[model samples]
Target chain A: MAVYTEVTDEALAEFLTHYNIGSMVAFRGIAEGVENSNYALKTTQGDFILTLYEKRVDPADLPWFLGLMEHLAAHGLSCPLPVRARDGKNLNPLAGKIAAITTFLPGVWPRRVLVEHCEPLGAALAKLHLTGAGFAPTRANALAPDAWAELLAKSAPRADSVQPGLGGELAQMLHGIVANWPRNLPTGHIHADLFPDNVFFLDGEISGLIDFYFACTDIYAYDIAICLNAWCFEKDFSFNVTKSRALLRGYMAHRALSEAETAALPVLAQGAAMRFLLTRLYDWLNTPPGAMVTPKDPLDYYRRLRFHNAAQGPAAYGL
Target chain B: MAVYTEVTDEALAEFLTHYNIGSMVAFRGIAEGVENSNYALKTTQGDFILTLYEKRVDPADLPWFLGLMEHLAAHGLSCPLPVRARDGKNLNPLAGKIAAITTFLPGVWPRRVLVEHCEPLGAALAKLHLTGAGFAPTRANALAPDAWAELLAKSAPRADSVQPGLGGELAQMLHGIVANWPRNLPTGHIHADLFPDNVFFLDGEISGLIDFYFACTDIYAYDIAICLNAWCFEKDFSFNVTKSRALLRGYMAHRALSEAETAALPVLAQGAAMRFLLTRLYDWLNTPPGAMVTPKDPLDYYRRLRFHNAAQGPAAYGL
Candidate 1:
């Protein structure tokens, strides 16, 4: 993560003065991310993640991000609670940006995930979805169906190709999708980035879920589609139909799908796939050189797009 | 993005002396990434990105990342050129991490990608593949196929309704693709992440390619699959066969595919699809609460995966 400005020990100590997490003792930088500078802090108060919101994270969103943690924690889901300052605010603008101390929860991310765990994740997600439903605080999906055509419209011209007539085909696909995406589905909060890195487990149990900056109002079942792609498939990149079923069964058990939701699954998956494919593609094409950032393979998601294109039905995903 | 420790502006000047760029007239945090802090630095010489490698960037591989930029630039790609320190070193240690400066190019991420850009992206990628061929630096695909499998193994237990029975099927699929991947077909440095965000353009032309952290020695065509998934498809998430053809055609124009590379197209695409689906899936299950990142939807790629899975020939992609 990016730590552009270094916080002195005294500065950190002073920053923690207002929070109730405890006393600052020691802090260590987490060298895994490419966005923000994070220090796994060990304070007399407790363990926490001391983050300086990097440029990538819009400063305006800090309170919303932090506020969600407090909200979710109070509602039931376990999360790292942002320690509010003496001013009775969770935010502490520091170093020309926002910074905060959040209580670090105790569960390690599961290295080995199982169907049983998927059950909990599905159930928890359902609960979270239900909780987020109609919550007073609302945000829109940053990358929504409406923006898809526009994003692709701009990027297609610059595509590198090995085929003579492929460019036209790409246009056709864009046109086709624009003509077919299902709208008017249930709109609510979605954990847009629910990857393995953000999950934490303890003794085979999904102890907590973190990261909510992308959480926004969108088709609720689209969240499930995102999960299907994330949890049910194998590393070889093929769908494990049975595992797919397990994850779905787990989800349905928690948040029973509406008839409408079921009908939209296939296309929603497509939308979701395209969303990722486009983002990966965009990131791939635009990543600045000489940066320490890593670029994901766009083809990786291209194959995924292929899957949803021809999926016979939601049943095909064992949904 | 998090400037926790405010530099008196004087300190920044001092620290910059150790940087490689000609001279840093002004610098400020621009964005915070999951991996690095990006600063739009206005050097007396030019605009550059001052990237401070967070702890996540392993120090050992810094050289490879640096060298790749030098190599790609030498190959005539318009990307960020790393600035060396006064000691004539490309690597610099700062804030308890690695950092560097890179020349900036001009381009706007297409708000909407069009079909026509696919061929150029494809063709340009072919050039990258050719130039980066045999240009071995330091890092291998740290998160290659094997590592992907290992990640799955760790998360398998958490699959919502995982059926190990499908493990065998997955294993076979893995074997099928692995046995046929174009390893030696055409060795080159592949811009693993060619997402729309990563590809830059000037006046709608592919002016520069960036983000080579995922660049590795692999079948150059695999990069094609990445782009097809990226540029050819629409955001609605459908696999536009025609668009796929265009992207492939674009790549073919720059570099003729070998029989092996052509033969491996579907398989490579299949593998590519699986890779994205898996990573997206992993992200779905592991989102860190409060982080602003969005997890990609795996269903988005499901259709693409099925296409590759059912591929009849390279002609399908118009390769």
Candidate 2:
């Protein structure tokens, strides 16, 4: 069970009246998280996951979550489709909080991920970006392109004390980045959390995706950059060229990158590095206690940023 | 100012009643971190950091945090010495939380960490372990060779699904590791978080050390493994042999390795890799949505583990 804010299930079932998910069958706390409360349910007819929207999930994002599922399902992607309520409303009030149920897709996250996994994940991302071609666009790109400055600013005060000139250099690099960010790449819905855990696997295949909460329309290439950061890096935190090549080739196979997308990748990679580094760095400076959360080392991404910063051109990363 | 908690200056002031510190002057929230709430504070005579225990910091472990700081400070280490409270107690009760303050060292964490940092940190670790010769001793040795099973078990469930019989193999590996874990070779104290951020630099020279939260007694060689994992791995997650060499050679200079220590490098590296893999994997499976924390890819350490798994002997790592 996660850190659900004192809400009880008996109180939560009140909202199920709005939804037509058959009789409340089996609901048990999912032990896979520390934030929201999730109950993997099994009704007379099917299996679904009931998610009790926790404090971190904004109420406004409910529709987006529902709508994205509908859109992705309508577009023929394998994902957890949100179940509509009896009132034909997607979201329902439960346990004095917002809650909803989504059909669960069966799959396992890969453990011994190899260069091979990179190819499919990249290609799947290409297809996923294309699948969200006409969904309701989102405005909540929390880790978007322009947030580097704000994040660096937050970390600036302690930068000299923590790591001299780190704040200044990060700010300067970001300024240079904004002035030259990529434009006009294939845009569609993106699964920002393309980490291995979110991508479900069934018998050596990517069965379906989870965690659409972070999905949105953005530069498709950035999705590739995220995967590269996510999948292509080696254990020592250096780039695995062979792995990177496999991933890029896989992405290109599914959706051919335009000359612009191709041209923008190195900088895109750098931008991607900056994005992860800034967020990780911000987290490093401002971690909340008792959250049971450990901030990822920003230095990991900092070194990657430095690597990409030194790249002379896109060809360096085989973009 | 962290998540759902706050640390009052009055409480910190109250806690500062004992100890040699002059007076608590200024304290403010650290804007970075996803685990603990840290405040940069200025005492009447010097700078210090006040950390209010947050999630992931169990209340029962407060003594270890305070005692390690006290112990390290007593041994002439330049780190934060926990301030005792007005009740003549070190741990203070504030905001329904346990908190402590330590002297802040002046220096930047190395930006371009070089070979030079390795030996100092290694020697420093050796010195700490030596000074920790004998105190009121009995604490969980996180780096102790015996803890590998618990480490592997945490990540075992998911790993079993991903790689069949993987958990058993890891368990067996642990059995062999414990049967052969290096022991009694100049064991004293160890700083588990020997990453670049915890190491300070002035003029690119090792100026001082801080962040002793993960300090414990264990195999002295395990300290080297921790550094190898921290320093040798690049952001892209690739292993850099040069950096690994620098780190290992640096450590070896302070505490020369016994033939057993030398022979233990490869297996210890594997155990180190597994330790990080388990923690990161635990994080991967258990991270909460809406948690500002971004889980580090367990795959990064998985790759490191895989690297070590393939090595035939300890000489492979040049210990």
Candidate 3:
């Protein structure tokens, strides 16, 4: 829940003058995305989302994110299309931050991961990967295996503060992931953070996907590995193989997984778990005093990493 | 900016089953109201606001508040009307809190008050009071003159912590206000808090009024006095008499002010300032450390109180 920047009325009115969407009828700061200030905006034309990129987002990558959405939408993918101003620019300045408007997609994110949701989610993920293959631009996954050692070094010092000897466990896990991580699998654009909250479902079908800020070029199977950790885990840290099987089956229906991709799933899943654990540990350690956003429990990923550490290849994930 | 209650998908789905508003398409917790968890809900039927009352509001008053909205909207006021469920109940339970849905009104609150906004605001206030006259239920203004002394006593001990010697000045002001507050003026239901943020405008017209949690029975002129301090004050802490004159003229056009009401405007305005100053000071002193919502600066009201203290009766307010 965040609205870090306050957009003034004068600045908003001035910003709207650049659009052909007619005068603003309503605008509200919505408690949605964590990295940006989002307003659920309604104009005489229609409803849209006005997002002011916050400091956490690198300004240089905004064109890539916006352009990726436009590219995906043009190819008939269900995603928010960046609305261009009358000046023909999708990105503009407002409230001392780069701002953009996008068409509002109507769907609620699933809070409870139903077994039926996995098929559509898996299908959408494969479609996103296939559709994004031809996009001209590329960005490296910042949280990939190579970056885990740096993350652990920063977070390992205080890991025991959250749980006794947790730092040593994380270091061992990071070392194993970095040494054995797959490098030969198929690579393409992946939603690196495809958490349940990022996917929207309507009428029990995947209606749209959002939060492309985490999109980056990475191993395609690694994206599937992220979903295995994100969608197949229960609150008690237990794996649900039924959900995993459904998700993998859904993806394979759209694009067949190569033999190398299937074989590398275990290490890839472990690396994926390590990626989240390190980041969550870093956030847990560095969250400022009185910060509004509560950091996710790094231990949840620690438990998942433990499972991946004990896994007997891709069969453990029901792949 | 608050969403105090977390509404789970299972609970929300169950809640929506009671309404014929169609299946839930989208639901997002909006950062609009401070007192409750407000979700911008979109169903197959249409858009609406779903509010879950937090602990700040009394549960017993839900009927009065919801009924008042129904009554006012029925009387042609452009405000959000409560949407009853299929069982014909507007108030229901959700997430262990009293929750209700209301029609979504389209308009943005003025972050920067303009002189032109004063006329429409004044006319709307008067119309609210007039239409609210026949509503049978009555709620006493909890922050009226009688409550000022208690509020000051609670805040005075640390008043100097905010501003040196502020406590003594507040005590003296409270004494003057309690002794001089008008009792014979015309009385009716009043929107005790008509700050700029609560009034929505579109195309320079007052499109809607909202946040009626503070509405209660009080002297009619006292409500005008609150508006005088709210709408007529510029950011620099200077009073804009032209705007004040237009506001008063607009109100008088709707319902003429009695001579006694006119004579008491200065004292009433001072009391209104004192009322807000004391509450703000209490909130400032008592806000828990690291609270998400920042308390307003009590000094702004202190300055307005000082202005009213030296004013030359109604003419000073552009009456």
Residue lDDT tens for model 2, A142-187: 7787666877888888866557788888888888878889877767
Which digits, one per residue and each the tens of the lDDT, describe model 1 over residues A105-224?
655444345566677777777877877664677776778877866776665665554234434555666566667777777777778777655676654567788777677777788888
Kindly report the fnat of each predicted structure, to 2 decimals.
0.02, 0.00, 0.63
> Candidate 3: deviation at residue A237, Å?
3.1
Q: Model 3 over residues A82-158: C-alpha lDDT tens digits?
A: 99999899999999999999999988887789888898888999999999998989998878878888888997778
Which run of 10 residues does model 3 chain A get worst, by summed lDDT? A287-296
Error of 2 at A305 (Å): 1.5
Can you tell me which runs of candidate 2 are displaced by over 4 Å? Answer: A31-35, A136-140, A160-162, B1-319
Predicted candidate 1: what Cα RMSD to the true structure?
23.7
Every model's DockQ, to 2 decimals?
A: 0.02, 0.01, 0.53
Q: Which stretches of candidate 3 lie over 4 Å from their true place?
A: A152-161, A164-169, A284-292, B149-172, B281-292
- Rank by TM-score, highest first: 3, 1, 2
Q: What docking grade applies to model 3?
A: medium
Off by over 4 Å in 1: A1-5, A111-113, A161-171, B1-319
In terms of TM-score, the best-performing candidate is 3
Tell me each candidate's RMSD, in Å, in order. Answer: 23.7, 26.6, 2.7
Superior candidate under DockQ, 1 versus 2: 1
Residue A250, candidate 2: C-alpha displacement in angstroms = 1.9
What is the iRMS for every candidate structure?
A: 18.7, 22.7, 2.2
Error of 1 at A77 (Å): 0.7
